[model samples]
Target: MPKCYWLGWSGQFEYLERAKQRLALVVPLTLALIFLLLYLNFRRLTETLIVMLSLPFAMVGGIWLMWFMGFNLSVAVAVGFIALAGVAAETGVIMLIYLDHALEEARTAARESGRSLTRADLHSAIMVGAVERVRPKMMTVVAITAGLMPILWADGTGSEVMQRIAVPMIGGMVSSTLLTLIVIPAVYGSVKGWRMGRGPLREGAPERMAA
Candidate 1:
């Protein structure tokens, strides 16, 4: 009769399991901290919510890239997502600030002209903000994506894991540009209007900013 012995997972596997267990708690704590920080920076729940919305928009691209690259969900992939979230939030912050600046400028101009903020002015301000920042935003996306491209193509030792990490970051950066430029502005415009309890273009116009 042959005796059979059971093989157990290696010590490294045990360690990873433990780390994965802790991650359940760690993830929520980190997300809460991110939300708190956004609230503190913006001082308005509406603005903070708009910035946080970008994180999910970023995930749309990251997940698509992961699927396209045939990477499974693993600790390394999760790490890539965490990194992507941070970058997405930062991009959101920049976009919001630019839009605010443009709106403020429009408000000032309208106040000086002794006229209400018309639809034309609102659209003009939105475009001013979006166009002025396009170069810098594209520069940021290109720089980060370019830096990660080599890793995505890496074939050396441990390249598989690296490529998994880089794929999402690249795709997320690409998609996040759209989120930051289009989605963020749209949401902020809506939120700003809601906060004023009126329509974005016609009611509660730029006159409020001057006061």
Candidate 2:
């Protein structure tokens, strides 16, 4: 009969257990903070929801890239995702700000002219806002990806941990940038268009829409 009962420090699985517990606590807090920030920034539940949706959209590439790299989820990866969320939210905010400014400009013009905001007005505003902001979006994405490049390609020492942290941010930035540049505007335009169309229709609305 033999019995093994020797313990030094914690145990073989202690590190993993600690990591899991840390992740469990941190993930929800991070998400809650993100949600609160989004709600505060947008001040409209629908707009906040739209921005929140972009977080998952941004994560798509991160998941795929991680899988392709054969990396499993870890604390570093979770941290990366948290960072990605903040950046994604920032990009979303920028896009929203541009769109809001454009819409406000159009709204003011329409109000001054004694006309209601129309789908056409919204469409034009969305186009101007989204397309005109491409330079800023590109710069942001480029700067982020460029900054992560060193971490992603680092070697030796703590490279493994650094890579895990950098991978999600790099991939996320790519997707989030696209979402900010394209999808968000499309979604905003669609929502605003539908809402505007539902309201009082202006004269020549159909003709203007067709043309």
TM-score of 1: 0.84
- Candidate 2 differs from the real structure by a C-alpha RMSD in angstroms, to one decimal, of 6.7
**Candidate 1 lDDT (Cα, whole model)?**
0.79
Off by over 4 Å in 2: 1-12, 198-211
Off by over 4 Å in 1: 1-16, 196-211
lDDT tens digits, residues 53-134, model 1? 7798888888999999888877788788888988898778777778777887887898899987665676788789888878
lDDT leader? 2
TM-score of each: 0.84, 0.86
The deviation in Å at residue 131 for candidate 2 is 1.2
Top model number, TM-score: 2
lDDT of each: 0.79, 0.81
